[model samples]
Target chain A: MKLPLLFTDELRGFYKSKLMLILWIGLPIIALLFRFAQTTSTGQDIPFTVISTIVISSLAGTLSSVMLAVSIINEKNRNVYTLFLIRPLKRRELLLAKFLSVYICVTIASLLAVFVGMTTDYITTGMLSTKLIDNTAQSLVTSLSMLAVSCAAGVLIGVASPSVMVGAILVIYGGNQISVIPLMPTILNITYATLFTTTTTLLTCSLLLIAAIGLFERKQF
Target chain B: MSPRNFRNQFVVLREVTKKYGGLTALKKISFEIGEGEIFGYIGPNGAGKTTTMKILVGLLTDFEGEVYIGGFQVPKQKSEVHKLLGYLPQSVGFQEWRTVDHALKTFGKLSGLTETEIEKRITEVLDLLALSEVRHKKIAQLSGGMTQKVGLGQAILHNPKLLILDEPLNGLDPLSRYQFKEVLLKLSKGGTTILFSSHILSDVQDVADRIGIINRGQIKQVGTLNELKEHLAEQRTVEVLLTYATDKWREFQNIKHVKSVEQPSVGRILVNIEKGSDPDDVMNDLAQLIVKQKIRIRGINLLSPSLDDIYQKYVQEGESI
Candidate 1:
């Protein structure tokens, strides 16, 4: 019951933050530019859909993680949560609300990138291939799973570390390194690669959320 | 409120102790605030005032003892207590992006009020705090005094039974301080028991019906202003500004109630008296004696210890230990 209010509040908050703009508008623009440059340089019909999907996935993974980490740490250090904690609100509701809001915003940004990428592919190639469709669809699922894990992991670091710099460093260097593993089986032609990454990511995200909630519940504001 | 009504305690802390690593923040703090009474919690910097407040409001749960509000345990029945209490923290940092009305609305909803109730209370609180003019203004655009006023507004919006305020007057100007006190007076009049912590002695003396002096995480004393004065009233000093220095001032020491008489300056004589002795009687006695001896007199003044003096005395005693 309380989560809904907190979710709406945090969602509205994130929508107004500069991070939203960077993810929703700025990141997609960069992905488009990168795809155009790749096509121009290669002089071969490199599918714009594949390049844009890669860019969005990679950028969303790193940017959403950093965004959630910094937001949680800043709120903690500034005692902003004090106002909410003194009420009937639970600690888990707060952390979970922030996680869901950031995750949802980044997911929307990724979907927008995919739509833009496919339209560009249609305009440049004049047709859509079945292979491109399958790859784009697979990449979307993989990217969603990876982004969820990264955002949750970032929240864990934010709650566990006392300083913002330490949390951000861990998210960028430590978390970023671990998140790349989910994509490995995909390229290696391992059996049920999507299943493997999806299962591992869901498990990791759940563990990270539990760890974050435990830390936040015991935190003194 | 009747004196008997104030005797019924509304809040109690039984040997509450809090420590952080190696540092002891609160050392067995124990006191009670009666219903409808303004209890002022006063102490110096780093004296554990905020810790005590946090414990009462359920913000800090890991502590060493018991706290009961309206007969409900803290941090366990915290939600039940939240319905009855309102808290104003020392330094409130509102989100700069939210407007004043929106921020208050959010707090009102968090306090479990419905939309209509939240609207009504927001209007009432804004009017009470004189913040109606800036209700829609962004928080970042408000001045310091206005910010403090909004902080106070949110605290009393729900009209809670107990209001816990930490350093509520930390940075307010004189006029704002006065207005804040007036709002508190109004709240207390409406049967709201207030526990206000402040480092400003005069402000405490002005509004608090009773005062608790804390130092080094220990409560040195808790009593009404008169009760505290009476505790130290045993020793009173009378200073007389005389027209001329008198070598015969020692002769007046024959009065049985007079403890000692000394002239530390050219035209001033200080007479020390025992407890329960009447200052007016001493002044009259000295006046009669001066007239009988044809002594020239300028003025007679009675100097009793103020609340500031009492606070300093307790703080110094704690420090000396």
Candidate 2:
């Protein structure tokens, strides 16, 4: 189905919003703080880029999920759906647009933090290991996949949960548990672990997004 | 398909029925609307006016009805039907955070206008509705009338051939109501078939080309305003305004055709008739008695019953039946 043309503008507005702004800049600043604090306390310099990526990725995932849930739940209660139902908008497209916009924003915030922090770390350290660079790229890919999954979960909770409070509880307690486990696996992985995690996250996200779209399409309002 | 012939014979509701769980909101209600026609669908609250409008605009399709817009079935052809239809819901809210321009842009895109074309059309609709200055204002900042205008603008932004307005005049101030009426009239003149619902009778009486009055989920009356007024008049009733109020007015109780003499207010008396009362005889006798009483009077006059009177007459008659 064609992504609804109607929600693109809404997506743009949301992506540039204050909530996304804090996530984009604040995550990197948090990475800088972590490195500075670590240096002051332990006197052993931590890789600023690596810490930035981890912090930003985790924050992005959580923020994206909550933003998705809050926006959909709030709009639903406002009878905003009534406005589009009268027009030619498809429900599936609306759900997809919202998911994609939040996911992309969170991903951008993560990437910006990692790239900038990595550049600064390289300058200070004067050298980077090949294995570390490869690991960094793998971590970025995995984190993006995880963020996508969180976004899809948010959409699912939005579609399934009838109200914002319920969706929030579900997203924070219910969705985070399942999606977050993939990021921090208890099982030991010898090789190709990042690829396995990325694939599983993408699959989960796709299934959840499909389910969300179907549920939304069937909603009365 | 040519837009003229297309717009002319639009909004065909065939054997439409809506059942909510065990309750039937609408039962096999059907009507046809043509271009340049202001069709007023009036009824009491919960009389399925909103339900019918919802079906027409493809909102509530759980209905067992075939709503056709420009020859498109509502359910099977909703994608096409919605393309040609503009619906203003009874109570739909905008995202308060969005500016008027932003909201209109979203609505325009959803209505299938191209991006650049959507902007141009937004400008046109805003200017047409005199909302150009408020385009940048947030929805939270606008007045009720201005917001209603924005709602109306969103509906007509893409210039749909068929427009459905559910209680569009509700909660509007008098001036806003007049402006809205003019906007609807202008759209109707442009070959847009308007299917509007209102409970207020006088508003519809002024502009509606054809009226369908639904009561308790069924259409009780449908015709031109004059025809409806006449039909209700023919149904066991004649209204006689007496030239003067006198204790002698109690004598109307003695007349065979005078079923009941009711003093509605201090100056007005309603002489309700039985099943077959000769209106001519009733008026003549009433005038003769008033003249003989030597009562200082204004003038005796026969009045066509209004929609409110018709509603009271039928509702009472229906209840007693």
Candidate 3:
């Protein structure tokens, strides 16, 4: 009961946020402009899908990190957790609810951004291919999943740290680097981008949620 | 459900202790508050008042010992207890970007209020708190007093049985303060048991049916205002203002428990008492002295200890539990 209610409430708060709105529109706008400039310059064989991956990953990391860090730090400073805890709400449930809300919002926003960028790239080129659209969709899924990993890293830092600036730095900077776990040591072979994105995203998010709940449960307030 | 069903259950705190690393936040504290009773919890800063409040609300569960709210064990039945508890935390963030209406609607729904009920209560509470004009304003745009009122409005909107407010009146203006008191009194009359903690002596004295003083995590005293006054009677002192300074003889020099008598202000002097002495006795002795000395026309009476005096006696004294 509490988990769903909390998730709904948090979703309402996040989707209506100015930051989410900015990312949903502005990030794609920037990605489209960069792709347009690139196509005009080289005019060779640059995949808009690749550019979308780069833009979405970078933007999603920054967005998720700042969003998670600000709210968590502000809540910690103001003791918002105490209010929820008194309402039949468990610490773990609260943490999970927040993570779910932010992750879902980011996922939706990231998809929208990818679609806008892909549509623009297709429009500018006017050479539509079902194969290109499929690849774009596949790449969109990959980037969003990668962003999910980034968001999970944010949740961990948000719960562990006491300040927003510190948490933001740790998540945005540290998350982008640490999310390369699948690519490191050729351990996962970095084979099949879809598999890598799915496995890395789910595993990373789960671990972060665990650490967040553990720390949040033992938090002073 | 009948309120009487939980009448026998107030709050049962048994051997509850909270330790933070090396610092003991709360020692082994045990007590019970009866249903429908207003319990005032007072303590200095960092005295663990918030800690104890957190435990009762099921916010701090890593502590030692058991807490039962309405006869249901906290760790075990926290969900049931939460259904019955309305809590106002000392400081809470509300996302701050949404309109007051949106925030209230969400909180109301989360508290299990039906949509229609939430709508009606939202309007009624906003009007009651004189915040109807600003209902559409974002929380970030609200003043401290208005924000606090919003916090309180959300807590009471669902109408729970036990209302726990941690410094509920911190930012209210004088008028809002009175209005809040009126609201609380109305709720009490409607039979909602309240447990509020504050460092403000007068507010606690005004609203609480009983006040519990805690220092260093131990509850030193807990009772009604009159009962606490009676308990601290021994520390009570008498003050007198004479018409003429030199008119009264120094007969108080012979009175027992009359530690010192000094005319600090013109025509007025405070009569300090020895430890563990009654103000009544001091008054009776002064009356005899007045009769014997034929002191000039003046004012003489034992000062009934104010909540301030009582608070100082307990918290400042740092008495052992």
Candidate 4:
């Protein structure tokens, strides 16, 4: 009950943040720009939906991760969690709420961008084939998995870093690299690409979240 | 442990000691607050007032102590204690994006209040804190005093049995301070036990039924205003006002009971009495000396040490050590 309440509070805060506005409006605009560029260029058979998913995933994932890490660090330094901690709320719930809120928002933004890209593909090419649908679904799954890893790493860096600058730096350098791990099997063309991305997402996200919770529980504030 | 006395005590700390590595923030300090009583925890900066409040609120857990809030041990039974406690931290911050109403609603819901109750309490708290006009305003838009009031509003939104406020009056204007003190007194009258910390002596002297002076992580003294004044009762001074400007009042210093004499103004002299001397005898002696010296006296009054004096004495003593 407390977790959900905190999650709603955090979601409401993130929903109105400038970062959320950028993700919601910026991602779709980027997809449209990609579609226009593809049409103007050589007009080759390009999987716009897959390309948009990858592009949106990278953009939304890094932005959301940086937002999470920086917000948490700023709030910690400002002692914003003092009032919340004094209530009947667990330390782990606070971190989990932040992670879930940012993850859900980024996921929604990613889906919106992918939908825009799919609509452009259908309009330009005038066909929705089985191969295209399969490719889009796989890309969407990989994108979501990558987001999970990035969000978890954001929380970890947020909990561990001392300041917002350090947290943002770590998220860009360390956290972005960690999120790329889920995209490994796809790049290498593994036998079970989907299965491997799913496994890596679960394992890495859980490990990062567990480490974050441990550090947060011991935190004095 | 000593004999358990839970008759009227709502919060109790026995031999509580907390340390950060080799630096001890709190020593073997002990104190108790009665139900519905306002216990003023006063100390200078870095005097462990915040550390003690944090321990009571269950924010700092690793410590050796026996702490009980409404008979529930802290950190061990913090969940149970949390239900009956409301805390406003010294340097607490709110999310700048959140409106005053939104922030209060979040705190209200987290406190397990029903939707209806939260709405009602929000209205009541906002009005009480004079923050109704800023209900829809973002926290970042509020002034320092308004923001501090919002912090107070959330702390009392749930109406817990015990409210622990750490430096709750730090950033308030004079009018806001008066109104805030009125709110505290009203809350106390409504049977809410409050333990507020402040370095402002006059504020504590006005609101606290019993004040605790802490310094160097040690409990220096704890008692009511008069009781603390009595601690320095023997060191009383008398203010003597002369009808005409003259230095003849210095003759009072030659009396046996008179310790020293100094003129604070052109016609007003302050006579310090000896420790064991009777104030009445000293007054009589000064009167006789003034008549003998042909000096006309306008008025004379005995004065006790102010809270400022007592606080400085204790704090300066701690600093010297």
Best by lDDT: 4
Q: Clashes per prediction?
A: 0, 0, 0, 0
lDDT minimum window of 10 residues, candidate 3 chain A: A180-189
Interface RMSD of each: 1.3, 2.0, 1.8, 0.9
lDDT value for candidate 4?
0.89
Which candidate has the highest DockQ of all?
Answer: 4
Name the runs in model 1 displaced over 4 angstroms. Answer: A184-188, B1-5, B243-248, B264-266, B275-284
Task: For residues A43-72, write the lDDT of model 3, one tens digit per residue.
Answer: 875666567667876777667766776788
Error of 4 at A79 (Å): 1.5
| Backbone-clash count (model 4) | 0
Per-residue lDDT value at A41 in model 4: 90
Which residue segments of model 4 deviate by more than 4 Å? A38-43, B1-7, B246-250, B288-294
Each model's DockQ score: 0.67, 0.61, 0.61, 0.81
Alpha-carbon RMSD of each model: 2.1, 3.9, 3.8, 3.2
TM-score of chain B of each: 0.93, 0.84, 0.90, 0.94
TM of each candidate vs. truth: 0.95, 0.89, 0.89, 0.95
lDDT of 2 at A90: 75
Q: What tens digits encode model 2's per-residue C-alpha lDDT throughout B136-229?
A: 9988689877887888998999998888888989888887788888888889878888989887777887667888877666677777777777
Better of 1 and 2 by lDDT: 1
- Report fnat in order of the candidates: 0.52, 0.63, 0.71, 0.83
